[model samples]
Target chain A: MTAIAGKQPNYKVAPPKSGMTIKQQALINSIIVNAIVILLVLLWTIPTFGLLVSSFRPRDLITSSGWWTAFVTAFQSGAWTLDNYRSVLFADAMGSAFLNSMLVTIPSTVIPITIAAFAAYAIAWLEFPGRKAFFLVLVGLMVVPLQMSLQPLFSLYQATGLNGTFLGIWLAHTGFGLPLATYLLFGYISSLPVDLIEAARVDGATPMLTFTRLVLPLSTPAIAAFAIFQFLWVWNDLLVALVFLGTRADVAVLTTRLSELVASRGQAWHVLTAGAFVTMIMPLVVFFSLQRFFVRGLMAGSVKG
Target chain B: MRSVQLNGGPVMALFEKTWFRVLVSLVMIMALSYGFMVSTEFMKNQDAPRAMLAIVAILVGVLGIWALYLTVDNLVSTFPIRIRDFVRPFVFIAPAAIILGVFIIYPTIRTTWLSFFISRRGTGVVPGSFGLQNYVSLFTDPATFRALINNALWLVFVPSFSVSIGLIIAILVDRIRWEKFAKSLIFLPMAISFVGAGVIWRFIYFRATFGAQIGLLNAIVELFGGSPQGWLRIEPWNNFFLIVIMVWLQTGYAMVILSSAVKGVPGELLEAARIDGAGEVRIFFQVIIPFIMGTIVTVTTTITILVLKVFDIVFVMTSGNFNTNVIANVMYQQMFVQGNFGRGSAAAVILFIAVIPVMVHNVRSLKSRRF
Candidate 1:
């Protein structure tokens, strides 16, 4: 949301009118920029790449030699194996944890979008009583530290019989997610031309009809953006799942499970690597596939408000 | 589903009246409650077959809400336009309000209340009698003091390093040939969970047997003829090692945002600076930096809040061991692990108080932007 509200940066390369000396200077500048960019890129990527390479290497080699050494004819030396993935997937029940992550993420993502779409539309277009006050509160709630809510919410869950259930975690995620979702969607929906909604109303379309038919379709970009953000967030979350759902194997999401593996199996780098990879795969897919929307969502959050 | 028309014959017209529609709304609400019950029960006992049932139950619950909406909409449609105008927005905002109030707002108040009272294990707060003993102990305890100091260190270091590196990379990468590809690499760490990043960097800092250091940093140390050291076991430095993971994760976010801001700087300004015989370094600091200062502040503020609540990395990496405890981790340990709900609530209240000024500033900025 912040990114979207900012002016789109001009990406055109400026051509210089210069003599031979200036041309050489430009070349030197380009060379320096390229060197620094390459160095930083490698610096950022090598750690994760090393972890990925270690995920494939045998446990003995992972603990015995640095992962970089495996890059030299790693496969040719027969240092690679599928055993880590197999053991993590089967023996450690990470496969079920992956499914559990999906189960927690899908409804958590969907319910918020559904609820926020309506709320955002109303805040954006309708002249309801206390509209500004309500919008202000929502915006303010965006920065509330979620740690404050954990203990009481956990206790409340016990009273309501929602504890340790998927429904409880889903509700927690939705509540935590709503402020920003509503805020981002409100930005997009509010910016939609008044003429369109007025035109729909001038016809015989009811408010619900207008929202379902016009607002929902028109707000897909915002919806897709929030969807991707929420999906990655819910899928990758460790804290909420740990607190609300507890660490029971059947209920543990991928992150909680992987963290538990780290705690209980601290020396098992092979399994940890593979398990980490397993948990990472979904968010990575969502991120890469929906990268444009994801970045848009980030920019939209700050720039709009 | 849309084919069902309420505007039909006399009998249908009678059913479409406000009273009949009100009955439908009530029934739909009951249906939604029932669906929730079934779903919760299904999820609570998830086994092989029941897992599938749980998934189906979720779908049923969602559909039930949708059906409730349709029913409520038909009821609202039966109202006069003026009444509908006011009622419809309330209808739309009600579900979100209920959930947020129950989950976030109510808990916030409850936590504040719990902070004043004492907690008993296995049960919740004792409710009426209130005291400041929890807060008193929270501030005086050495562990908490260390945690506060560590949080201050994180607040200072993480944002500063992240913003500076991000600014440097963003400035450097813009003139390169593979700008998008390189920026993507820098931004890649933001995609990994903090837990995952912790594991990745743990490998980077791994220490093996003497003379056979396996971690990249330790290996590099050994290659320089220095002996290997346990990176995470060392106090103060271990905190720095953990901070490195956060810097790695956040720099990409800062870079991507700042890169766009840098690109937004007008070309003429840079050209004018260059014509005045300014070097690139001076152009960057004096001309370019000043232009994008707002975005730089925005990025810094964003990372500042993140550093404040940074629990996942510390939780996963050191579990606050070796003097790495921060406020959020300490709060969590007190609340859940130690079952000191009163103290945990106090810690949480402290965190909430810390966040209020930032959020208020954010809201004011947003309001100013609107006009």
Candidate 2:
């Protein structure tokens, strides 16, 4: 961190006053590190790039053309076209599924964060009995696999007449998500300096007032970080929505809808690629907007929001 | 002391003064009423012809008794003259607790119970007494035994490999200028859901086996004059390919945590080591690795749990066919697909039991960590 410290900004800098050979070794070391990073990045990005490219190229071109081959005439047997995107979007069948994803993602994200914030604040500030035991259980919920309880939950949902309903999915997501959210927010918010709350309290603020006026502002970074994760989880969810949303196209999420699209029209790789990218838009937006805080917040280890 | 008595402590304390005892008595009386009333109602409905309604009534009757006391308390002076110190936190965590218990805990117990019975297609319930028959059959069956072994392999390789790579990256990236962007690039896979990533990898690993080759992997192989092999169709080895997808998705998460832990290593210690003629490799192992061991263990255990319950990837990729079945996916087939809820539930119970030892140890370690 202090490498740039005690340095003159305008002067040409000399390195370590070491021997020429050592300096050469350091330069070589940096190159190797950068080269490895570049290679890894290409390996990671090429497939997605290929899919994206294949999505746009005429279907046959995708079969014959390397995504990287677009650079040459030999690979360019056909011109690029929007046929796949048009088929997925203008085609009345898939458009509604896109809307359905919106419905699930929006509410699934909002309700959990709202409830968690309130509960987290209470756990953080409010004194009560069995708090330790409750905290323990909340953390433990993180370990239970969703698939294990899924059958019993299905039966329960059936009994409650919530099977195959948006409301049911909402409730299920909230139920599954609450434990982690509370544990995370509780860990973060509770560790905030008690002086902030006490200072507010001394001014005759009630608990609610103290939380809203003092705690929430400080905890915003943590809340935002969790929101990004929960939003992505619910958005990219397939099995949860599949079991609860039923086979109906009208209620299925982007994931379930996309998988169904794959089976019914996997031939149309064009739309699948576009649709995948479209589904990716929200998370990418969320990630970029909160990128700086992402590392800091995660690194803070839930102890500081 | 005089003020304590005078202020309604115990100077021949009036009913209001001694209301704590009264409240306790009232609670006991309400609980007794609830138990008796619920038992009577439950007995009345025990003979109900419809199985579902009878079960519902049994549940409702028991819950109704507890509801009655809560209602009665609300109607009267719910709060004592002095607020109960513990009530506020209960109010805070109560909603979360109640939902988790009903949804998570109750279902867990239900699964364990159902595992004991037989729900074959031949009968509504597994028509027999409870024993270790299902578990015994599970272990004895060659197919199931293989799946159990595969799941164990996943537990060993997926978490450990992903975490190891993450540790390596974290160490490497800490020295880089564009660390955040580089880290996010790796983390990008995690943003894609297992299903979404599964869809993408399917195409990458796509094998037509004949005609014009399209899959990127096979396409590249053919480009290199290598024979096209159906990657996903290969047994045993195919599991490693599947594990790669999980590694791809999770390495970023592990990286973020481990990177943070790596960063948390004190600079002075590393600087001192450097002064003592320690090379970068030695300093990393001796200083950084030891500091981050706790976090690495936590990440490993968490990822192990994920691996043990691994379902979606196998389901989406191989559909658990071709000997790629993990425990959770197999459980689904047995319970839902095969309609052998007993066997399925048994599979689930076994998985749960397998997890408890690790889960208990994790909770203990997590709690034992100083705040």
Candidate 3:
């Protein structure tokens, strides 16, 4: 586990202490484990710091005072206001629903990592015929339930007019993100080193030139960790963009335009706290700039399913 | 004849004619199915110039499937090499097996054959409405038996309080020292959006009837003097305040996968179970919970298949409305707000027979890793 989450454990092998000796019982057990991990990291960061301080206070001091009283009226003057992020980014359009959540998360994360990296390099280095029954039917279609294919793929995308387009929610998020992007790029292109795909097939090349010049550049860190896990599962998808992109406003997206501004500005807590921080500023800037390839592609997809 | 007269005579004898390379691979699969029907009709038009023709129809539908797999690998290298190694791994597994057989295996066998029949108002499916009357009105529907006991109390309290508060914040942030800045602030609500953590826990379960209580859980229940309540309309504890917004958006994906299985236990087996005297809570339940019990059943069956398709925290907090519904928000209120396609394909075939025992324990642990 990345060597115990990157070292620091050897507390001088302290166990046999008595009468508060071993460095004062390891400084009272590191101040009772850093005060219960800073009180469970302040109860998991005070409900996202009380909706990012009621999305910068204003609207009548956020429904008459309480985002912990704007840290005790910190320099009062109508305490904080980017006019609730300039009226949820230009008067509630949430800046074209943040360009329709980057037009439905950059081609639903580059057409499901280019059709699951050509079917995970043909089920990790081709052989052909039913290839282990198409990799155990892509690990039994990774636990099927997208409510059993959303009502017959919404009546086959309303009979091919592909219900609310953008190439029908980018071919329905490349068939619900191709069975966990061909089972996490076939667990990193079937653990590569088969003598570099038999030295690009004994030099003659061609399995489409050894999968586009030897397994697509040694599977770019499992295709950039399943492209940040299919761009934060198609940018925090709200039921596959509300059943294949619908709630219209120029093809809604930032979680279906922040769940229609929490059902038509639910008590306009400053336009649902600056429209839920403009649909959480691109999955919190791709979860804090690729948090180690989103926790190593979420522990290589929950330690292989 | 002599390498077809040194490879250029009548274009290498019409590319070594096997009926002229199967009529040029059936005219390049009918011109790549008429360039994917004119870029899916210029990505469903919307007054043209659409963001430069939908970025040139998403770069010709992802480089038109890599130019139809490099023209079917140069028409399977003009075949005849034992049918070019038996049609080249179905040309790199036919566009991910025809888009996972037309979007998830033929719409999960056409929503389990439209959950056996009868569909009225939302039109279609009627003619001699088949049998098992929509799984007997989805087990005699009292609002789908309160969405099957709020999807079995969100499958037993959202995977046991998101794997026991993500295995106690992955063993108290693996004994701090800013353990990666407190495990990235409890995995920052797994990067928000369950409708932006249901509008940040609907502003900490906001209640406010008259004055003060601007919901930080009704201003700490009106600073301990009690009063304010409606934490998502109380009935049956508003289904555990909508299963504490799916255990606060799945306890940071069970604390970053049980903090990498509690830093994969082994620190000389926790200093040989603290030199045999074993204390630190009995070396965390006998040596780091039996050495991260296979990453705590792989983060409790990957949060029990994401709390059995929970559905955007009860469709953005209580759209299930007091006495919260679940089986994927009653199969999206019986298929798109009461259109009732045979009780929403029998509530999506009871969430595909409750995800066939976690898809046969993830295909028997991917056939015991014999990938």
Better of 1 and 3 by TM-score: 1
DockQ of 3: 0.27
| Interface CA RMSD of each prediction in angstroms | 4.4, 8.6, 16.3
**Candidate 2 wrongly placed segments (more than 4 Å):** A1-20, A73-78, A90-92, A199-205, A264-268, A293-305, B1-80, B83-89, B120-122, B209-211, B365-371
TM-score of each: 0.93, 0.81, 0.37
Question: Which parts of model 1 are misplaced by more than 4 Å?
Answer: A1-20, A75-77, A301-305, B1-29, B47-54, B80-82, B122-129, B368-371
lDDT of 2 by residue, B62-143 (tens): 3443354333333233455346333534544555667778767888888888788776644757456687777877899888
DockQ of all candidates, in order? Answer: 0.46, 0.23, 0.27
Error of 3 at B198 (Å): 18
Instruction: Give lDDT: candidate 1, residue B132.
Output: 98
Better of 2 and 3 by TM-score: 2
| TM-score of the A chain in model 2 | 0.84
Model 3 chain B: which ten-residue window has the lowest total lDDT? B45-54
Give residue B345's lDDT in candidate 3 (0 to 100).
74
At residue A294, what lDDT does model 2 achieve? 53
Q: Per-residue alpha-carbon lDDT of model 3 for B51-126, expressed as tens digits?
A: 7756876777688778888877777777779988888888778878888888888888888887788884547788
Worst 10 residues of 2 chain B by lDDT: B43-52
For A1-305, candidate 2 gives per-residue lDDT tens digits of: 44733342413333344556545877888888888876776777776677777767776666665545655653444567777777766572456666667666655666666667667887667766655666666666666667667778888877766677665676678777777777778778989987878888788765655665688788887887776667677877777887777657656667776777666665455666766665666666766777765544443322210
**How does residue A284 of candidate 3 score in lDDT?**
79
